[model samples]
Target: MEYTYYPGCSLEASSRGYDESVRFVFNALGQKLIELEDWNCCGATSYMSTKETISLVISARNLALAEKYGRDIVAPCSACYTILYKTNHILKNNPIMKAKVNQALKKDNLEYNLSLNVRHPLEVLVNDFGIEKIVSKALIRLDGVKMAQYYGCQIVRPDRGLDDKENPQMMDSLFEALGAENIYFPMKVRCCGGMLMTTYPDVALKLNKEILECAYGNGAELIVTTCPLCHVNLEAYQDKINKKFKKDFHIPILFFTQVLGLALGGTPKELGLNRNLIPFQLKKTALEATK
Candidate 1:
Protein backbone atom coordinates (compact mmCIF):
# COMPACT_ATOMS: atom_id res chain seq x y z
CA MET A 1 0.00 0.00 0.00
CA GLU A 2 2.13 2.83 -1.27
CA TYR A 3 0.95 6.13 -2.75
CA THR A 4 2.36 9.55 -3.51
CA TYR A 5 1.07 11.77 -0.71
CA TYR A 6 0.30 15.43 -1.39
CA PRO A 7 0.18 17.31 1.93
CA GLY A 8 -0.83 20.54 0.15
CA CYS A 9 -0.33 23.99 1.71
CA SER A 10 -2.83 23.81 4.55
CA LEU A 11 -1.47 20.48 5.83
CA GLU A 12 2.03 21.94 6.02
CA ALA A 13 0.94 24.96 8.05
CA SER A 14 -2.28 25.13 10.12
CA SER A 15 -3.19 21.49 9.53
CA ARG A 16 0.18 20.01 10.45
CA GLY A 17 -1.63 17.74 12.86
CA TYR A 18 -3.51 16.16 9.96
CA ASP A 19 -0.24 15.39 8.19
CA GLU A 20 1.23 13.87 11.36
CA SER A 21 -1.82 11.80 12.25
CA VAL A 22 -2.34 10.69 8.68
CA ARG A 23 1.27 9.50 8.50
CA PHE A 24 1.01 7.78 11.88
CA VAL A 25 -2.25 5.96 11.12
CA PHE A 26 -1.14 4.92 7.67
CA ASN A 27 2.22 3.71 8.97
CA ALA A 28 0.45 1.72 11.68
CA LEU A 29 -1.61 0.08 8.97
CA GLY A 30 1.60 -0.88 7.07
CA GLN A 31 1.15 1.71 4.34
CA LYS A 32 3.80 3.96 2.87
CA LEU A 33 3.10 7.59 1.95
CA ILE A 34 5.75 8.99 -0.34
CA GLU A 35 5.30 12.74 -0.36
CA LEU A 36 5.57 14.62 -3.63
CA GLU A 37 8.77 16.62 -3.70
CA ASP A 38 8.70 20.31 -4.68
CA TRP A 39 4.94 20.28 -5.06
CA ASN A 40 3.45 23.77 -5.23
CA CYS A 41 0.10 25.03 -4.05
CA CYS A 42 -2.99 23.64 -5.81
CA GLY A 43 -4.32 27.26 -6.19
CA ALA A 44 -7.30 26.35 -3.92
CA THR A 45 -10.90 27.46 -4.64
CA SER A 46 -10.47 31.22 -4.73
CA TYR A 47 -7.72 31.19 -7.35
CA MET A 48 -9.91 29.16 -9.70
CA SER A 49 -12.55 31.90 -9.82
CA THR A 50 -10.01 34.66 -10.45
CA LYS A 51 -7.26 33.00 -12.47
CA GLU A 52 -8.75 29.82 -13.88
CA THR A 53 -5.96 28.91 -16.30
CA ILE A 54 -3.16 29.45 -13.83
CA SER A 55 -5.10 27.50 -11.24
CA LEU A 56 -5.61 24.62 -13.62
CA VAL A 57 -1.97 24.66 -14.66
CA ILE A 58 -0.74 24.78 -11.11
CA SER A 59 -2.96 21.85 -10.17
CA ALA A 60 -1.99 20.09 -13.38
CA ARG A 61 1.68 20.38 -12.39
CA ASN A 62 0.94 18.44 -9.21
CA LEU A 63 -0.89 15.80 -11.25
CA ALA A 64 2.09 15.59 -13.58
CA LEU A 65 4.53 15.25 -10.69
CA ALA A 66 2.49 12.44 -9.15
CA GLU A 67 2.41 10.69 -12.50
CA LYS A 68 6.20 10.68 -12.50
CA TYR A 69 6.04 8.50 -9.40
CA GLY A 70 3.68 6.18 -11.28
CA ARG A 71 1.38 5.98 -8.25
CA ASP A 72 -1.96 7.45 -7.29
CA ILE A 73 -1.87 10.73 -5.36
CA VAL A 74 -3.52 10.96 -1.92
CA ALA A 75 -4.38 14.45 -0.66
CA PRO A 76 -5.69 15.05 2.86
CA CYS A 77 -7.10 18.51 2.27
CA SER A 78 -10.57 18.56 0.71
CA ALA A 79 -9.93 21.87 -1.05
CA CYS A 80 -6.73 20.55 -2.57
CA TYR A 81 -8.44 17.30 -3.51
CA THR A 82 -11.33 19.12 -5.14
CA ILE A 83 -9.07 21.44 -7.10
CA LEU A 84 -6.71 18.74 -8.22
CA TYR A 85 -9.46 16.26 -9.01
CA LYS A 86 -11.48 18.85 -10.87
CA THR A 87 -8.43 19.80 -12.90
CA ASN A 88 -7.79 16.20 -13.83
CA HIS A 89 -11.42 15.66 -14.79
CA ILE A 90 -11.52 18.77 -16.92
CA LEU A 91 -8.20 18.14 -18.70
CA LYS A 92 -9.27 14.61 -19.43
CA ASN A 93 -12.58 15.67 -20.92
CA ASN A 94 -11.75 18.98 -22.55
CA PRO A 95 -8.87 18.49 -24.98
CA ILE A 96 -8.70 22.15 -26.00
CA MET A 97 -8.48 23.21 -22.37
CA LYS A 98 -5.90 20.49 -21.78
CA ALA A 99 -3.75 21.91 -24.60
CA LYS A 100 -4.10 25.39 -23.14
CA VAL A 101 -3.06 24.12 -19.70
CA ASN A 102 -0.10 22.26 -21.21
CA GLN A 103 1.07 25.47 -22.87
CA ALA A 104 1.30 27.05 -19.41
CA LEU A 105 3.04 23.94 -18.03
CA LYS A 106 5.57 23.97 -20.89
CA LYS A 107 7.66 26.58 -19.06
CA ASP A 108 8.18 24.14 -16.18
CA ASN A 109 8.60 21.09 -18.43
CA LEU A 110 5.45 19.50 -17.00
CA GLU A 111 2.57 18.01 -18.91
CA TYR A 112 -0.56 16.30 -17.60
CA ASN A 113 -1.79 13.31 -19.53
CA LEU A 114 -4.22 12.43 -16.76
CA SER A 115 -2.36 9.20 -15.99
CA LEU A 116 -2.72 9.32 -12.20
CA ASN A 117 -5.76 9.30 -9.91
CA VAL A 118 -6.24 11.86 -7.14
CA ARG A 119 -7.73 10.50 -3.90
CA HIS A 120 -8.46 11.93 -0.50
CA PRO A 121 -6.91 10.04 2.44
CA LEU A 122 -10.41 9.12 3.63
CA GLU A 123 -11.14 7.56 0.27
CA VAL A 124 -7.87 5.61 0.37
CA LEU A 125 -8.46 4.34 3.91
CA VAL A 126 -12.08 3.32 3.48
CA ASN A 127 -12.29 2.23 -0.14
CA ASP A 128 -8.79 0.99 -0.91
CA PHE A 129 -7.40 -0.02 2.53
CA GLY A 130 -10.68 -1.53 3.85
CA ILE A 131 -12.32 -1.40 7.28
CA GLU A 132 -11.31 -4.90 8.32
CA LYS A 133 -7.65 -3.94 8.11
CA ILE A 134 -8.20 -0.89 10.30
CA VAL A 135 -10.29 -2.92 12.78
CA SER A 136 -7.58 -5.54 13.11
CA LYS A 137 -4.99 -2.85 13.85
CA ALA A 138 -7.03 -1.03 16.46
CA LEU A 139 -5.45 -1.22 19.92
CA ILE A 140 -7.70 1.23 21.74
CA ARG A 141 -11.46 1.02 21.46
CA LEU A 142 -13.43 4.28 21.43
CA ASP A 143 -16.58 2.78 22.87
CA GLY A 144 -17.87 5.75 24.87
CA VAL A 145 -16.96 8.53 22.44
CA LYS A 146 -19.84 10.00 20.44
CA MET A 147 -18.69 11.60 17.20
CA ALA A 148 -20.18 13.54 14.29
CA GLN A 149 -18.58 12.91 10.91
CA TYR A 150 -18.38 16.24 9.08
CA TYR A 151 -17.46 15.89 5.39
CA GLY A 152 -18.11 19.57 4.74
CA CYS A 153 -18.99 20.82 1.21
CA GLN A 154 -16.11 20.50 -1.28
CA ILE A 155 -15.28 16.79 -1.22
CA VAL A 156 -18.67 15.29 -2.03
CA ARG A 157 -20.09 18.02 -4.22
CA PRO A 158 -19.88 18.34 -8.06
CA ASP A 159 -20.38 14.56 -8.36
CA ARG A 160 -16.97 13.30 -7.26
CA GLY A 161 -18.52 9.87 -6.51
CA LEU A 162 -16.52 9.41 -3.28
CA ASP A 163 -19.70 9.26 -1.17
CA ASP A 164 -23.26 10.50 -1.01
CA LYS A 165 -23.57 14.23 -1.72
CA GLU A 166 -25.92 14.97 1.16
CA ASN A 167 -25.08 12.30 3.77
CA PRO A 168 -21.64 10.72 3.59
CA GLN A 169 -20.90 7.55 5.59
CA MET A 170 -17.19 6.95 4.95
CA MET A 171 -16.05 8.64 8.13
CA ASP A 172 -18.95 7.04 10.00
CA SER A 173 -17.81 3.62 8.86
CA LEU A 174 -14.22 4.32 9.91
CA PHE A 175 -15.33 5.59 13.33
CA GLU A 176 -17.55 2.53 13.74
CA ALA A 177 -14.54 0.33 13.06
CA LEU A 178 -12.75 2.13 15.92
CA GLY A 179 -15.77 1.50 18.21
CA ALA A 180 -16.94 5.12 18.41
CA GLU A 181 -20.66 5.94 18.30
CA ASN A 182 -21.54 7.98 15.20
CA ILE A 183 -24.16 10.61 15.99
CA TYR A 184 -26.84 11.20 13.39
CA PHE A 185 -25.89 14.66 12.17
CA PRO A 186 -27.96 16.12 9.34
CA MET A 187 -25.51 18.97 8.80
CA LYS A 188 -22.57 16.65 8.16
CA VAL A 189 -22.32 17.63 4.51
CA ARG A 190 -23.10 21.31 4.96
CA CYS A 191 -20.73 24.14 4.05
CA CYS A 192 -18.23 25.46 6.62
CA GLY A 193 -18.02 28.77 4.67
CA GLY A 194 -14.21 28.10 4.34
CA MET A 195 -12.27 31.25 3.32
CA LEU A 196 -15.51 33.14 3.89
CA MET A 197 -14.30 33.06 7.49
CA THR A 198 -11.80 35.69 6.34
CA THR A 199 -13.75 37.47 3.57
CA TYR A 200 -17.33 37.49 4.86
CA PRO A 201 -16.82 36.64 8.49
CA ASP A 202 -20.36 37.53 9.49
CA VAL A 203 -21.79 34.96 7.11
CA ALA A 204 -19.01 32.53 8.03
CA LEU A 205 -19.80 32.81 11.73
CA LYS A 206 -23.50 32.33 11.04
CA LEU A 207 -22.95 29.22 8.91
CA ASN A 208 -20.48 27.82 11.42
CA LYS A 209 -23.00 28.44 14.20
CA GLU A 210 -25.58 26.40 12.36
CA ILE A 211 -23.13 23.49 11.95
CA LEU A 212 -22.00 23.68 15.56
CA GLU A 213 -25.59 23.82 16.81
CA CYS A 214 -26.58 20.83 14.74
CA ALA A 215 -23.64 18.76 16.01
CA TYR A 216 -24.16 19.84 19.62
CA GLY A 217 -27.90 19.29 19.44
CA ASN A 218 -27.27 15.73 18.27
CA GLY A 219 -25.12 15.16 21.40
CA ALA A 220 -21.84 14.81 19.58
CA GLU A 221 -18.83 14.79 21.88
CA LEU A 222 -16.66 16.07 19.04
CA ILE A 223 -16.80 16.73 15.31
CA VAL A 224 -14.47 14.84 12.96
CA THR A 225 -13.55 16.23 9.58
CA THR A 226 -11.37 15.46 6.55
CA CYS A 227 -10.98 19.08 5.46
CA PRO A 228 -8.48 21.37 7.17
CA LEU A 229 -10.55 24.49 6.50
CA CYS A 230 -13.61 22.91 8.05
CA HIS A 231 -11.59 21.84 11.09
CA VAL A 232 -10.18 25.34 11.57
CA ASN A 233 -13.54 27.02 11.03
CA LEU A 234 -15.45 24.69 13.36
CA GLU A 235 -12.80 24.53 16.09
CA ALA A 236 -11.31 28.01 15.99
CA TYR A 237 -14.56 29.88 15.34
CA GLN A 238 -16.51 28.29 18.18
CA ASP A 239 -15.62 31.09 20.61
CA LYS A 240 -16.58 33.77 18.06
CA ILE A 241 -19.71 31.87 17.22
CA ASN A 242 -20.49 31.63 20.94
CA LYS A 243 -19.93 35.38 21.37
CA LYS A 244 -22.13 36.27 18.41
CA PHE A 245 -24.90 33.82 19.24
CA LYS A 246 -24.72 34.34 23.05
CA LYS A 247 -24.08 30.68 23.78
CA ASP A 248 -21.35 28.41 24.99
CA PHE A 249 -20.19 25.78 22.48
CA HIS A 250 -16.96 24.15 23.61
CA ILE A 251 -17.12 21.11 21.42
CA PRO A 252 -13.81 19.63 20.26
CA ILE A 253 -13.35 19.40 16.49
CA LEU A 254 -10.75 16.81 15.47
CA PHE A 255 -9.46 15.31 12.29
CA PHE A 256 -10.58 11.74 11.59
CA THR A 257 -6.90 10.69 11.32
CA GLN A 258 -6.17 11.93 14.85
CA VAL A 259 -8.82 9.61 16.32
CA LEU A 260 -7.75 6.84 13.97
CA GLY A 261 -4.19 7.29 15.19
CA LEU A 262 -5.43 7.07 18.79
CA ALA A 263 -7.38 3.86 18.13
CA LEU A 264 -4.26 2.41 16.52
CA GLY A 265 -2.37 2.92 19.84
CA GLY A 266 -0.74 6.23 18.92
CA THR A 267 -0.15 8.62 21.78
CA PRO A 268 -1.70 12.09 21.80
CA LYS A 269 1.67 13.76 21.21
CA GLU A 270 2.51 11.25 18.52
CA LEU A 271 -0.62 12.24 16.65
CA GLY A 272 -0.28 15.99 17.41
CA LEU A 273 -3.54 15.97 19.39
CA ASN A 274 -2.34 18.80 21.65
CA ARG A 275 -2.19 21.10 18.61
CA ASN A 276 -5.97 21.18 18.39
CA LEU A 277 -7.61 24.45 19.55
CA ILE A 278 -10.21 22.44 21.46
CA PRO A 279 -8.39 19.65 23.31
CA PHE A 280 -9.45 16.04 23.83
CA GLN A 281 -8.67 15.71 27.54
CA LEU A 282 -10.43 12.41 28.07
CA LYS A 283 -8.58 10.76 25.21
CA LYS A 284 -5.34 12.21 26.50
CA THR A 285 -6.09 10.83 29.98
CA ALA A 286 -7.03 7.47 28.51
CA LEU A 287 -3.77 7.30 26.57
CA GLU A 288 -1.76 8.32 29.61
CA ALA A 289 -3.50 5.77 31.81
CA THR A 290 -2.76 3.02 29.30
CA LYS A 291 0.88 4.12 29.27
Candidate 2:
Protein backbone atom coordinates (compact mmCIF):
# COMPACT_ATOMS: atom_id res chain seq x y z
CA MET A 1 0.00 0.00 0.00
CA GLU A 2 1.07 3.55 -0.76
CA TYR A 3 0.41 6.64 1.35
CA THR A 4 1.47 10.27 1.52
CA TYR A 5 4.09 10.56 4.28
CA TYR A 6 4.15 13.65 6.52
CA PRO A 7 7.14 13.62 8.90
CA GLY A 8 6.17 16.86 10.63
CA CYS A 9 8.86 18.95 12.37
CA SER A 10 9.95 16.66 15.21
CA LEU A 11 10.53 13.65 12.97
CA GLU A 12 12.70 15.80 10.69
CA ALA A 13 14.86 16.95 13.58
CA SER A 14 14.77 15.63 17.17
CA SER A 15 13.17 12.32 16.25
CA ARG A 16 15.43 11.37 13.35
CA GLY A 17 15.45 7.82 14.69
CA TYR A 18 11.70 7.60 14.16
CA ASP A 19 12.03 8.95 10.64
CA GLU A 20 14.83 6.52 9.77
CA SER A 21 13.11 3.52 11.33
CA VAL A 22 9.73 4.41 9.83
CA ARG A 23 11.16 4.58 6.31
CA PHE A 24 13.18 1.40 6.89
CA VAL A 25 10.28 -0.57 8.35
CA PHE A 26 7.76 0.50 5.71
CA ASN A 27 10.16 -0.21 2.84
CA ALA A 28 11.01 -3.58 4.39
CA LEU A 29 7.29 -4.38 4.49
CA GLY A 30 7.09 -3.64 0.73
CA GLN A 31 4.87 -0.61 1.39
CA LYS A 32 5.52 2.75 -0.24
CA LEU A 33 5.58 6.14 1.55
CA ILE A 34 5.65 9.07 -0.85
CA GLU A 35 6.53 12.09 1.27
CA LEU A 36 4.29 15.10 0.68
CA GLU A 37 6.37 17.75 -1.01
CA ASP A 38 6.42 21.34 0.31
CA TRP A 39 4.68 20.17 3.46
CA ASN A 40 4.41 22.54 6.45
CA CYS A 41 3.69 22.16 10.13
CA CYS A 42 0.28 20.79 11.19
CA GLY A 43 -0.10 23.90 13.45
CA ALA A 44 0.22 21.54 16.48
CA THR A 45 -1.80 21.89 19.72
CA SER A 46 -0.74 25.39 20.73
CA TYR A 47 -1.94 27.20 17.60
CA MET A 48 -5.44 25.83 17.99
CA SER A 49 -5.75 27.44 21.43
CA THR A 50 -4.75 30.88 20.10
CA LYS A 51 -5.32 31.29 16.35
CA GLU A 52 -7.93 28.70 15.50
CA THR A 53 -8.52 29.70 11.88
CA ILE A 54 -4.85 30.09 11.08
CA SER A 55 -4.15 26.70 12.66
CA LEU A 56 -6.88 25.01 10.64
CA VAL A 57 -5.77 26.73 7.44
CA ILE A 58 -2.13 25.73 7.88
CA SER A 59 -3.08 22.16 8.83
CA ALA A 60 -5.55 21.98 5.95
CA ARG A 61 -2.92 23.07 3.45
CA ASN A 62 -1.06 19.77 4.01
CA LEU A 63 -4.37 17.95 3.69
CA ALA A 64 -5.11 19.83 0.44
CA LEU A 65 -1.74 18.78 -0.92
CA ALA A 66 -2.31 15.17 0.15
CA GLU A 67 -5.74 15.14 -1.48
CA LYS A 68 -4.08 15.53 -4.86
CA TYR A 69 -2.26 12.29 -4.24
CA GLY A 70 -5.64 10.56 -3.64
CA ARG A 71 -4.19 8.54 -0.78
CA ASP A 72 -4.20 8.52 2.99
CA ILE A 73 -1.60 10.78 4.59
CA VAL A 74 0.47 8.92 7.19
CA ALA A 75 1.88 11.12 9.95
CA PRO A 76 4.59 9.72 12.28
CA CYS A 77 4.33 12.39 14.94
CA SER A 78 1.40 12.04 17.31
CA ALA A 79 0.79 15.79 17.57
CA CYS A 80 0.80 16.15 13.79
CA TYR A 81 -1.48 13.15 13.38
CA THR A 82 -3.98 14.58 15.90
CA ILE A 83 -3.85 18.08 14.43
CA LEU A 84 -4.33 16.93 10.83
CA TYR A 85 -7.09 14.52 11.88
CA LYS A 86 -8.83 17.35 13.74
CA THR A 87 -8.55 19.62 10.70
CA ASN A 88 -10.17 16.96 8.50
CA HIS A 89 -12.98 16.38 10.98
CA ILE A 90 -13.74 20.08 11.49
CA LEU A 91 -13.65 20.92 7.79
CA LYS A 92 -15.94 18.01 6.98
CA ASN A 93 -18.54 18.93 9.61
CA ASN A 94 -18.34 22.71 9.79
CA PRO A 95 -19.27 24.29 6.47
CA ILE A 96 -18.41 27.85 7.61
CA MET A 97 -14.94 26.86 8.75
CA LYS A 98 -14.46 24.78 5.61
CA ALA A 99 -15.33 27.78 3.46
CA LYS A 100 -12.77 29.95 5.24
CA VAL A 101 -10.00 27.29 4.90
CA ASN A 102 -10.79 26.69 1.24
CA GLN A 103 -10.83 30.44 0.59
CA ALA A 104 -7.35 30.73 2.14
CA LEU A 105 -6.10 27.78 0.05
CA LYS A 106 -7.53 29.37 -3.11
CA LYS A 107 -4.76 32.02 -3.04
CA ASP A 108 -2.27 29.20 -3.56
CA ASN A 109 -4.42 27.51 -6.21
CA LEU A 110 -5.33 24.77 -3.71
CA GLU A 111 -8.50 23.47 -2.12
CA TYR A 112 -9.55 20.73 0.27
CA ASN A 113 -12.76 18.79 -0.38
CA LEU A 114 -12.13 16.85 2.84
CA SER A 115 -11.37 13.77 0.70
CA LEU A 116 -8.24 12.71 2.59
CA ASN A 117 -7.61 10.54 5.62
CA VAL A 118 -4.98 11.40 8.23
CA ARG A 119 -3.50 8.24 9.75
CA HIS A 120 -0.80 7.34 12.25
CA PRO A 121 1.92 4.87 11.23
CA LEU A 122 1.03 2.59 14.14
CA GLU A 123 -2.53 2.22 12.91
CA VAL A 124 -1.42 1.86 9.32
CA LEU A 125 1.07 -0.86 10.25
CA VAL A 126 -1.20 -2.83 12.54
CA ASN A 127 -4.49 -2.27 10.70
CA ASP A 128 -3.48 -1.92 7.05
CA PHE A 129 -0.42 -4.20 6.87
CA GLY A 130 -1.70 -6.71 9.43
CA ILE A 131 0.25 -8.01 12.44
CA GLU A 132 0.47 -11.53 11.05
CA LYS A 133 2.24 -10.24 7.95
CA ILE A 134 4.58 -8.21 10.15
CA VAL A 135 5.30 -11.26 12.31
CA SER A 136 6.05 -13.33 9.25
CA LYS A 137 8.73 -10.81 8.21
CA ALA A 138 10.53 -10.83 11.56
CA LEU A 139 14.25 -11.67 11.46
CA ILE A 140 14.56 -11.29 15.26
CA ARG A 141 12.20 -12.17 18.07
CA LEU A 142 12.05 -10.18 21.32
CA ASP A 143 11.24 -13.17 23.47
CA GLY A 144 12.18 -11.78 26.90
CA VAL A 145 12.62 -8.07 26.18
CA LYS A 146 10.30 -6.30 28.59
CA MET A 147 8.79 -3.11 27.18
CA ALA A 148 6.33 -0.47 28.29
CA GLN A 149 4.32 0.68 25.28
CA TYR A 150 3.71 4.37 25.92
CA TYR A 151 1.00 5.91 23.69
CA GLY A 152 0.95 9.21 25.56
CA CYS A 153 -2.14 11.53 25.47
CA GLN A 154 -3.01 12.58 21.92
CA ILE A 155 -3.18 9.61 19.54
CA VAL A 156 -6.18 7.89 21.07
CA ARG A 157 -7.97 10.98 22.29
CA PRO A 158 -10.97 12.74 20.62
CA ASP A 159 -12.06 9.25 19.61
CA ARG A 160 -9.81 8.74 16.57
CA GLY A 161 -10.99 5.10 16.27
CA LEU A 162 -7.36 4.02 15.98
CA ASP A 163 -7.45 1.92 19.14
CA ASP A 164 -8.94 1.78 22.60
CA LYS A 165 -8.55 5.29 23.97
CA GLU A 166 -8.10 4.35 27.61
CA ASN A 167 -6.27 1.07 27.07
CA PRO A 168 -4.74 0.72 23.62
CA GLN A 169 -3.82 -2.81 22.58
CA MET A 170 -2.52 -2.28 19.04
CA MET A 171 1.06 -1.76 20.18
CA ASP A 172 0.77 -4.46 22.77
CA SER A 173 -0.66 -6.94 20.28
CA LEU A 174 1.94 -6.17 17.63
CA PHE A 175 4.89 -6.46 20.04
CA GLU A 176 3.44 -9.59 21.59
CA ALA A 177 3.15 -11.17 18.15
CA LEU A 178 6.87 -10.41 17.67
CA GLY A 179 7.49 -12.21 21.00
CA ALA A 180 8.18 -9.13 23.14
CA GLU A 181 6.84 -9.08 26.68
CA ASN A 182 4.34 -6.24 27.07
CA ILE A 183 4.53 -5.12 30.70
CA TYR A 184 1.32 -4.18 32.49
CA PHE A 185 1.60 -0.45 32.20
CA PRO A 186 -1.42 1.63 33.27
CA MET A 187 0.30 4.93 32.47
CA LYS A 188 0.55 3.96 28.80
CA VAL A 189 -1.99 6.59 27.74
CA ARG A 190 -1.12 9.18 30.40
CA CYS A 191 0.10 12.66 29.58
CA CYS A 192 3.87 13.04 29.22
CA GLY A 193 3.46 16.81 29.97
CA GLY A 194 4.16 17.59 26.24
CA MET A 195 5.03 21.27 25.69
CA LEU A 196 4.78 21.76 29.42
CA MET A 197 8.35 20.57 29.55
CA THR A 198 9.35 23.96 28.15
CA THR A 199 6.71 26.08 29.84
CA TYR A 200 6.57 24.39 33.25
CA PRO A 201 9.64 22.34 33.90
CA ASP A 202 8.68 21.31 37.40
CA VAL A 203 5.31 19.93 36.33
CA ALA A 204 6.66 18.19 33.26
CA LEU A 205 9.52 16.69 35.21
CA LYS A 206 7.18 15.28 37.81
CA LEU A 207 4.94 13.87 35.12
CA ASN A 208 7.82 12.22 33.34
CA LYS A 209 9.16 10.94 36.64
CA GLU A 210 5.88 9.21 37.31
CA ILE A 211 5.90 7.60 33.87
CA LEU A 212 9.49 6.38 34.22
CA GLU A 213 8.90 5.20 37.74
CA CYS A 214 5.88 3.20 36.59
CA ALA A 215 7.78 1.59 33.75
CA TYR A 216 10.75 0.75 35.93
CA GLY A 217 8.60 -0.56 38.72
CA ASN A 218 6.84 -2.82 36.26
CA GLY A 219 10.23 -4.27 35.29
CA ALA A 220 10.34 -2.60 31.87
CA GLU A 221 13.86 -2.46 30.52
CA LEU A 222 12.82 0.11 27.94
CA ILE A 223 9.91 2.36 27.09
CA VAL A 224 8.60 2.40 23.52
CA THR A 225 6.46 5.31 22.44
CA THR A 226 4.64 6.71 19.39
CA CYS A 227 4.90 10.44 20.16
CA PRO A 228 8.15 12.29 19.59
CA LEU A 229 7.36 14.81 22.29
CA CYS A 230 6.60 12.00 24.71
CA HIS A 231 9.86 10.31 23.83
CA VAL A 232 11.78 13.54 24.42
CA ASN A 233 10.06 14.35 27.68
CA LEU A 234 10.66 10.89 29.06
CA GLU A 235 14.14 10.32 27.63
CA ALA A 236 15.86 13.71 27.67
CA TYR A 237 14.68 14.77 31.13
CA GLN A 238 15.79 11.69 33.07
CA ASP A 239 18.73 13.52 34.68
CA LYS A 240 16.54 16.44 35.66
CA ILE A 241 13.79 14.17 36.85
CA ASN A 242 16.32 12.27 38.89
CA LYS A 243 17.76 15.42 40.42
CA LYS A 244 14.37 16.85 41.37
CA PHE A 245 12.71 13.65 42.49
CA LYS A 246 15.82 12.50 44.42
CA LYS A 247 15.72 9.17 42.60
CA ASP A 248 17.75 7.38 40.00
CA PHE A 249 16.04 6.72 36.64
CA HIS A 250 17.78 5.71 33.46
CA ILE A 251 15.47 3.91 31.09
CA PRO A 252 16.02 3.62 27.36
CA ILE A 253 13.23 5.38 25.50
CA LEU A 254 12.73 4.20 21.92
CA PHE A 255 10.30 4.60 19.07
CA PHE A 256 8.12 1.57 18.36
CA THR A 257 9.36 1.66 14.76
CA GLN A 258 12.95 1.20 15.91
CA VAL A 259 12.07 -2.02 17.71
CA LEU A 260 9.94 -3.22 14.80
CA GLY A 261 12.72 -2.42 12.34
CA LEU A 262 15.11 -4.62 14.35
CA ALA A 263 12.61 -7.48 14.01
CA LEU A 264 12.47 -6.73 10.26
CA GLY A 265 16.26 -7.27 9.90
CA GLY A 266 17.39 -3.65 10.37
CA THR A 267 20.69 -2.91 12.09
CA PRO A 268 21.01 -0.90 15.32
CA LYS A 269 22.90 1.88 13.54
CA GLU A 270 20.44 1.92 10.64
CA LEU A 271 17.48 2.18 13.03
CA GLY A 272 19.21 5.03 14.96
CA LEU A 273 19.27 2.99 18.15
CA ASN A 274 22.82 4.09 18.92
CA ARG A 275 21.66 7.69 19.14
CA ASN A 276 19.46 7.08 22.17
CA LEU A 277 20.55 8.97 25.28
CA ILE A 278 20.27 5.85 27.44
CA PRO A 279 21.79 2.93 25.59
CA PHE A 280 19.89 -0.33 25.00
CA GLN A 281 21.23 -3.55 23.55
CA LEU A 282 19.43 -6.84 22.99
CA LYS A 283 21.48 -9.86 24.12
CA LYS A 284 23.66 -11.63 21.54
CA THR A 285 22.24 -14.90 22.78
CA ALA A 286 18.72 -13.65 22.03
CA LEU A 287 19.84 -12.52 18.57
CA GLU A 288 21.44 -15.91 17.84
CA ALA A 289 18.41 -17.71 19.24
CA THR A 290 16.13 -15.83 16.84
CA LYS A 291 18.37 -16.76 13.93
Which candidate number has the best lDDT? 2
Total clashing pairs in model 1: 0
What digit string (tens of lDDT, one per residue) describes model 1 on residues 69-115?
A: 88999999999999999999999999999999999888989887889
- Stretches of candidate 2 above 4 Å error? none
lDDT of 2 by residue, 147-214 (tens): 99999988899897768999999999999999889999999999999999999988898899999999
| Clash count list over all predictions | 0, 0
Backbone clashes in candidate 2 total 0
User: What value of lDDT does candidate 2 attain over all alpha carbons?
Assistant: 0.93
> How far in Å is the alpha carbon of 133 misplaced in model 2?
0.6
lDDT for predicted candidate 1 compared with the true structure: 0.89
Off by over 4 Å in 1: 283-291
Backbone clashes in model 2, listed as residue pairs: none
Candidate with the greatest TM-score versus the true structure? 2
